[model samples]
Target: MVKLDGISSFVAIAEAGSISAAARRLHLSKSVVSERLAELEQHLGAPLFHRTTRKLSLTEDGSAFLERANRIVWEVQDAVAEVAERRGSLSGPMRLSAPVTFGRMHLGPALYPFLARHPGISLTLELDDRRIDAAAEGYDAVIRHGTVEDSRLVALPLAPSRRLLVAAPDYLARHGRPDSLAALRQHRAIYYTNRNVADWRFADVRQDVFVRPPAALRVNNGDMMRDAALAGLGLALLPSFIVGEELRAGKLVRLDIGHEAAQELIYVAHPEGRRASHKLRTLVSTLREHFGTPPYWDVV
Candidate 1:
């Protein structure tokens, strides 16, 4: 019979991305974890992960095994919980992924209180701008900011990620405020390097508004882009989550050509057709509650 401990170690390593990290999560020594993984791989007759000095990634077979592994782990945990007379407190490790800025500014702070409420739940959060393969990476949930086309996952919309075209007061003073698309092009731009900077779209009411300014600065981080814009660098088309305070305060001015920019729906996604554990369900519920309707970020 396959050992459950080995499977648990495998899942931990996949999620944590390193032997040492996984060992820390399992509260086991590195050698013991390594032995468990070696035994598990030997039984399966294939290498589950590709290991380098600095990083570890799943092999193709490992990717296929991960989803089933998750199901097995959660099912066993649920079975025990049922036998335990449905204990009042829920406890398990939840792995989550999100964009850096959103996680730092919103998700992390909001979820910490949930952790306090349920002291038994353990959370490992990965914050990156790059899109992740949640199942392959062993994350219980992933927060995404745009269209989630992967049919393998169930996506629950969190909120409307509304955007705005804004510039610093000094920048507007020097370059003159743009009242229309043509005038908007006259100013330079601060670009977000990850997405397509050239093809910007707006809402229906703001159809007359368009921008393709020459890029003066390019950065992948929202915080850096916001800081650059605040330094009187150039106009920036930024999400309200990142610049909402600046727009509300006197730090920045929104160039309302006609209406707001296009709003992409943000979503929380997890593997489809799988039963979520009580711990995962709690996190999802907490997130939905925290980011509903107008969304907390847009409040101020």
Candidate 2:
């Protein structure tokens, strides 16, 4: 009989690309993971991976086995979740990833109450700005802002995020406020390098415009961009969640350039093939409820 533990370890190894990565995800020693894989391979009388000094690649058999392995692991999780649901309790680990700024400012606070309600569930939250392969990384859910084009994943919309051109009152006083998109191009702009498009795009009923102002400062994080704008460094195109409070308090002023800035949707996504456990569903619902229609951050 194939041991379920061996099958699970195989699935983790296949998805994670390396045993070391899989070990980290599974919270197991490398030796233990290796042993499990070796045992499984022996039972099947076939090598699962082509080992190399640089990397590990799945063998033909390993490639064929991965889909079935994922199904088996998901089915087991669902079985356990079914029983837990009947008992009115949730127990297991939920691994999640989100952008560093949003995770720290919003997602963390939103998750606290959910954690409080389900004391039986263990939580692992990773705050990262880079896009992640959720299945390979073994995340239960990934909170992302922007377009989710991965058809392999099921995306559940959390909230709407809009970007606005903003600057501090002092900065505007020093540099003069931009009355039009043309005037905006002459001023120093704070550029967020992490986004795919360097140019800012805006649209209205009448027309669409793209602006690429000269960069006074280039930053990878939204909070830093907001800070630069707050410190009178330069005008920044920043998301509402980052600058909404400052905008409301008059610390930062929004530029009315006729066209509305780009809007992106925030989503909590998981692999489509992965079965949603009771805990995962409840957490998604909790986040949606917590953020509300316009999101608490966008009230301004």
Candidate 3:
């Protein structure tokens, strides 16, 4: 029989990405964690992770083991929770991944109260602009912007978020706003580098199409673009959620052409066909209820 305690250590390492991180999460010493992983590999006669100077990544074997290990860990947790809930307690760790700006400006602030409500539930939230492989990375949930691309995940729309093209009031006052997509060609623009800077899409009642705008500056950070636009650098096409405050506060002005602005739906996503836990279900439902009908952005 495989030692379940040793399996827990492996799963922790895989989820945390390093021995030190896993050790910290599990409240174990690094040397002990390392030794346990070595023992597991020795017992299985196969390596689970490829170790390097900085971090660890799962080998093909490790990937397979992680999938099984995640199941085992969850099963054990569920079993314990089921027995404990008779005494009235809901508790476990939840790992979440999200885009940096959205997490920082939106979800981070929103989650504080949720955390306060459920003090027993531990949460590890990672914020990054790059997309993460949630299942492979062992993330419990992911909050993302834009249309859902991967159908393998169960995507639940939490709020109505949109993107808009805007420039500072000063920039608009100086250069004047473009009245058509054709007019945008001559204007300098700021863009999120991770997105296709050269090709942009616009849609409205009159026109729905893509435009290739000339890019003057490309940056991956929304905060940077916000700053650049505020400094009178160029027109920026940004997510409405990030710029909603500035737009409402008169620092930025929306450039509305006839039927050119488009809106995107945001979602909380997880792997499809899996039995989502009450914790995930609760958060998803709470967000949906909190932001229904144009979300908090429309409030101001």
Candidate 4:
């Protein structure tokens, strides 16, 4: 295989206009640069330069090869930068995907400080409610909720996904709040369409219980669901982070159910072997730090 060193030397010599000039720029002896050029030319079976004391210029084959050589050199430099970023100092673009609701409510606040701290990194945040293939979709990392089924991904837990059954005070007054799990059947439901089929799960002492509430209105986004609850449409099970502000403002009321709500897991997933990248590691750490144990949003 033709070595990258030779290709890089060829590119430098072509750009610098002579092996001697390239040697000066590279801090190498002219002889070494000439030898590298000769080796590359030998490997390709072509004379890359029209050499004379007066001037140096590229031949036809050399012109075509120079383009590829330049690209190769650039690729080599980029690879070095990528490795360097993973080792310590951070730079380059970081592509991240996340669920719309959690990202806006939680990750959005945390990201500002992280970006401020690392000015070298350019971040792209893509928000989608549907689960995407992290590797196939070309994301550096993704924020996901509940059980991470993709064994190909490495996960870092960000927070506990605690959902609250809530409704507007007007709805509760008009419809009457259910005091227990069984009473939920009597309530009209505003469903988050993205939720699991056996959606409502709760804790009853050491065991678990599941309920599928009948849906009066179904929507894909959490913010819309929160709006529905605030509009007094019906009772909805919403993640704490999305409804924290509404709950705190007394626009929505959390029912004191007889059993504990089952907790789900929130994770940041990356393609396997990607956890070591400084960009991914730093982002995950920042999110973990922001969320903490019970998470600030869940305190209410």
Whole-model Cα lDDT of every candidate shown, in order: 0.82, 0.87, 0.79, 0.81
lDDT of 2 by residue, 18-50 (tens): 999989989999999999999999999999999
Determine the C-alpha RMSD for candidate 2 after optimal superposition of all C-alphas.
Answer: 1.9
Worst 10 residues of 3 by lDDT: 203-212
Predictions ranked by lDDT, top down? 2, 1, 4, 3
Compose the digit string of candidate 4's lDDT tens values, residues 58-155.
99999999777766765665676588776766777677898998888788899999999888888888999987887645566888877778899988
Say which candidate scores most in TM-score.
2
Query: How does each model score on TM-score?
Result: 0.81, 0.95, 0.84, 0.70
Error of model 1, residue 264, in angstroms: 1.4
Question: Ten consecutive residues with minimal summed lDDT in candidate 4?
Answer: 204-213
Off by over 4 Å in 2: 204-209
Tell me which residue pairs clash in candidate 1: none
lDDT of 1 by residue, 170-274 (tens): 998898998876776788988887776443676663434444788889888889989999999998888889998888897988887765666687788887766
Tell me the deviation in Å of residue 4 in model 1: 0.7
- Candidate 3 lDDT for residue 255: 85
Q: Runs in model 3 with CA error above 4 Å?
A: 13-27, 45-66, 81-87, 197-199, 204-209
| Among all candidates shown, the one with the greatest lDDT | 2
